[model samples]
Target: MSRLGVLRAVCVAVGLLPALAHAFLVNQWETIDTSTKRAQAAQDVQPGRAWIEPLTGMDMVWVEGRCFKLGSPPKMEGRDGDEGPVREVCLSGYWLARTEMTQGQWRRVMRNNPSKNRKGDDYPVEQVAWDDVEMYLGRLNSFYTGRVRFRLPTEAEWEFACRNGGQQVRYATGNSAEQGSWFQRNSGGVSQKVATQRANRLGLFDMSGNVWEWTQDAYDSHAYKQIEPQNPLRLGAHPFRVIRGGAFDSKPAALRCSNRGFEHFSLQAANIGLRLAAEVEKPVKPRPINLRDTLL
Candidate 1:
C-alpha cells in the first residue's frame, strides 16, 4: 500500500478519525452553537458580575462607579502638556468589555474585518475609523432594541476604568511599565492576541499597552479646564477624537494611564482599535428570608 493509504488505515485502526472530526466540528461556530457549551457561554449579563454578552459573546465586567481625579497630577513622572490641571470625576457603574474588541467579534457584527494585521480572529481589529465604529455600535445596539446600549467609552470613562475604577493607578495594568502588556520594548513591531498578558487589578487586559483605543470624546487640549465632575464627555469642537492606551510602538511615557492622544476622526491606522462599554442599571439587592415573618 502507498504511504498515505497506510497512514489512513493506521489512523482508522487506531480510532483517531472520530476524535479529529469532533474537534473540527466544534471549532465551527454554527455547528457547536447549538451545543450546551456554547449556550452557557451566551448567557445574559448579570449586573455586578462578569458574563458573556449573548449577541457577541463578549466577556463584560462590572465597574462600580466612583468619584476620582481625572488627570495626571502636576508632579507625576511622564506628565504631558495636556494631562494636567487635574479635575475631579464622578461616574456611574457600567459594563466594559474585558479586552479590546477582537477581529472575530468585529466580523461577526459587521460581516467584514478591516484589520491590517489579519493575524487571527482573537487579535484586536484595527484600521477602522471612528465613524466606522459608530456604525458598528449602531448595529450592535439594534440587537437589544433599547434594552442596553453599547458604544465606545468616553475619554473620562476610559480613564476611569484604566485607573482601576478610579483608584489612582499610573498605568492601565496598575503599574508603571510593560509588566502586563505588549509594547515597543517587547511587541516585535506587531499586534498580539488579546488577553495574552496578565489582567490588571480590575481584571482588564492591555490597559497599559496594546493598540491605541478609540474613545467617544472629541479632542480638546483644554478640555480639562472645563471638566465636569460626573460622566464628562467632550464633543463637537474639533475633527480629532480622543484615543487612549498606547499602541505597540508607543513608549512607556505614552502608556501612562493619564497620557492622552487623539487623531482625526476619519483617521484609521493599524495601531488603532477599540473596546466597548454599556451603561447598566444597578443590580437590585435581594431581601433576606426571615422565618419570623410567618409568625407575624
Candidate 2:
C-alpha cells in the first residue's frame, strides 16, 4: 500500500475513537441508572446482583449502605412533633421493591384481592392490616424455595428511601408533594395506579403518597433516641406498628418524608398497605470431605 493511503487509514481510525468511547460510556451510564444494585455507576456493580421478585415481577433497587441523619429537624416546615430529635443511622445494603404491592400481585399470592379500589389491578393493594401483610410475606417466602428473605422496611429504611437515600427533601421527589404524589387534593378520593406519580432518585414510586406503607418497626414516640448505627428494627410489645408515606386521603403535610404515622396491628383501612423489602441469600460453600472418615 502507498504511504499516503496507510497514513489516511490511521487518521480515519483515530477520528472514530472519540465516538466509540462516547458510546461506551453512555451504555454503562444507562446500565448504572437501571440496575438494581448498590452501583451508582457501571464501576460499582460487583459479582453479586439484584433480581426481580419472581412472584410479583416487581423491580427492586439496592439501598447502598451509608450513615444518614433521620427525622425532621426542629422548625422545619411540616415537621411532626415526633419527627424531632434527629438521629444518625447507618444501614447495611438491602433490596427494596420499587413500587408498592399491586392488587394483581396480592391476588396471585393471597388468592383474594382486598383492595377497595377494584377499578384496576395496578392500584396499590389496600385495606390490609399488618397481620395480613405478615401472612402474605410468609406465603411469598414459601413460594421462593428459600432463595431470598422478604419483609417490610424498617422506619429508617422507609425514610431513607423516601428521602432518596437520605437527602433532606420535604417529599420523596422534592419539596413539592404534588409533583411526586397523589394526595387528598389531587386524588379525587380514590387510590390511583402505582407509579402514576414521579419516582424518587432511586426510581422508587409511590413513596410519598398513594397508600400508607406499613414498616416492620413498632411505633414509639421515643424510639429515635435509641437508634443504633447499624440496621435498627424497633420491635417490642408495642400495640401499634409504624405506617409511613401518606394515603390518597392524606394532606400534603402528611406526605412529608419524615411524617410518622401508625395503625393498630389488627386494623385495616382502605388507604393502608405495604411495600416489600428483600435480602438475597449468600451462596453457601461446602466443606471438603475426608475420604478416611468416609471409609469408616
Candidate 3:
C-alpha cells in the first residue's frame, strides 16, 4: 500500500481518522493592516536568514540562539503573580518551528484526527495531549537520521523566539497588533492561514496569535522567581507543561508575548498545538565519551 494509505489505516485503527476530509485554507496575513507605513516598512525588512525544514517528518525553524529575560517584570499591566519576579536566561543555538503543527502535517505522520472539530490542512492541529506529542516525537526521531534531535522548546526559548531575539517591542511584531496578527480587534472570528501573517524579527510566523504552542518546561507558578537568569531552567520531568502563544478563540490580552498558561499532558484541548525543536549539531565520534569512564 502507498505511504498515505498506510497512514490512513493507522488513523483508522486509532479512531482518529475522519470519514470525510475537508480543506481549510487560511490567509497567512489576513489581519495585517496596510495603513501603517512605518510598521509596514519594518515588516518588509528580512526577519533573518533562518529557513524551515521538515525533519523527522515534522516542520521546524532554525533558531540562532542567545540570551534574554525569562519572566515578566513586576509593573507590567495585567501581570500574573506567577509571571514574576523577572529573571535572565541564556540558551544555546537551536531550531524551532515557525508555527504549530497543522492537520496536514500531523496526518502525514500520525495519520489521525485528534481534533474534536476537523478543520482544513492549514489549520493548527488541536486536541492533542502533551504526552501524545511526545509519542509523535519518538516516531519522528526514528524516521530521521541526524545529529540534531527533536523535542519541544523551553518556556524561555519560546518567549525569546517569539520576541524575535532582542528586537522586542511587544507581541512579535513590535508594539502593534495591526502590523501582522489576529487578535480580538481582528481575526474575523476564526483562525487564518499559517504564513500569511507577518513574521517576527527571526522570520518566525504565527508566534503570537494562531494557537498556543506546547513547550518543554513543566508548569510551576513560581519557578521563574527562584531560577537563575542565565540558562533558564527547563524542568520537563515536572507535571503541567507550559503552552505559549494565544489561540484563535483567545482575546488580545491572552495573545500578549509574555502571557502564560498550562494544561496536563493528557488533556487534549482545541486551543493547543505544537512546534518542534532540534538541537544544534556537534561533531561526533562513535565512542566520544566512554560510559564507564564518565561514571567514575
Tell me the alpha-carbon RMSD of every candidate: 12.7, 18.0, 10.7
Q: Where does the lowest 10-residue lDDT sum fall in candidate 2?
A: 30-39
Give a tens-digit lDDT track for model 1, residues 1-296.
Answer: 99757766787899887776666555665522323433453345556777777757788888888888899888888898799789998988888899999999998777678899998999999999999999998877656533456888988888988888887887877575757878899999998899999888889998778899999998889999986778899878588999999989898988888889999989989999999998653356889878899689
Best by TM-score: 1
lDDT of 2: 0.83
Clashing pairs in 1: none
Per-residue lDDT of candidate 2, residues 1-296 (tens digit): 99756765776778965665555555553221223321232233232355565456776788886899999889998787888599898988888888998998887677677888988888899999999999998876665433467889999999999999999899998989878899999999988999988899988999988899999999988888876768988899898999999989999998998999999999989999899987755667897999998999
Candidate 3 structure quality by residue, lDDT tens digits, 84-203: 776767777777776667787776566566875465877778888889998988875554344455788878888888787744456887766667776556776566667788888777
Q: Which stretches of candidate 2 lie over 4 Å from their true place?
A: 1-50, 282-296
Error of 2 at 60 (Å): 1.2
Q: For each candidate, what is the lDDT?
A: 0.83, 0.83, 0.70
